[model samples]
Target: MTRTRGWLAAVVDIVLIVAFALIGRSSHAEAASPIGLWTTAYPFLAGWAVGWLVVRGWARPMRLWPTGVVVWVATVAIGMLLRVLTGQGDVAGDPLPLSFVIVATISLAVFLLGWRAVVRLVAARSGRRGRGRV
Candidate 1:
C-alpha cells in the first residue's frame, strides 16, 4: 500500500462526509452551490478534525474500533454542538431538537464508519486469497 493512500485517508473522509450534507441539502431542495454546501459542511468538518485529533487518527486510520468509532461519535457529537451555534435546526428557544440529535448520531455513525468497515472486510478477504484474486 502506498503511503499516499494512508496519508490522504482524511481527504477520502472529507469527501464522503461532505456528501452527507450535500445529499441532505438536495433532499430538502436547498441550493447545492459550493459555498452553500461548504457552509453546511464546515461544522461537521471541524468536528471531524477534532475527532482525528482525539484519536490521533493517523496512527491507525483504517482500524474499526477506537479510530472509526471515535471519529464517528466525535463527528456527530461535536457536529451537533456546532449546529446549535449555527442556528440551522433550532425551533423556538431550543437550539437543538431531540430528533435531530438522534438522527445525526445514527446517520453519521453509519456513513462515517460503514465504508471503513467494508474496506477492511474487502481487504481481509483479498489478502487471504492473495492479491488480485478479485
Candidate 2:
C-alpha cells in the first residue's frame, strides 16, 4: 500500500481507538486524559506501521502478524511507562483493560489483512505496464 493509504488506515484506526477509549472511560468512570488517548492509540499506530512495512517489502506479511503483536505490546507497555514517569496515571498492576487489548488486536488484524488486499487491488486496477525494447 502507498504511504497515503497507510496513513489513512492509521487515522481511521486512531479514530476508532479514541472512540473505544472514550466509551471505556465513560463506562468505567476512569479519568481519560490526553496521555490515556496516546497510550490507547499507540497500538493502532503500530499496526499501521507494520502494515506499511509489509507493503514496502521490508518484511514478510506473514511475519508481520508477530511484528504487529510485538509492536502493540511494546507501545502499550512503553506508554504506560511514560504515564508512570509523568505521573499522569498510577502504575496499577493492570496498566490496560481487556477492552483495550481486544480493540488493539482487532485493529491490528484488520489493518494488516486489509492492507494487502487493497494494495493488490489498486495495483491490478492500475494495470501493469512494460518497458519498450527490453
Highest lDDT model number? 1
TM per candidate: 0.87, 0.42
Model 2, span 1-134: residue lDDT tens: 54555455445545654665566566668778888666655544554455445454234332335543444444455544554454543336655556555654565445544554565667666665432324
How well does candidate 1 score on lDDT at residue 29? Answer: 94
RMSD of 1: 2.7
In candidate 1, how many clashes are counted?
Answer: 0
- Candidates in order have lDDT scores of 0.83, 0.51
Off by over 4 Å in 2: 30-67, 91-134
lDDT of 2 at 3: 51
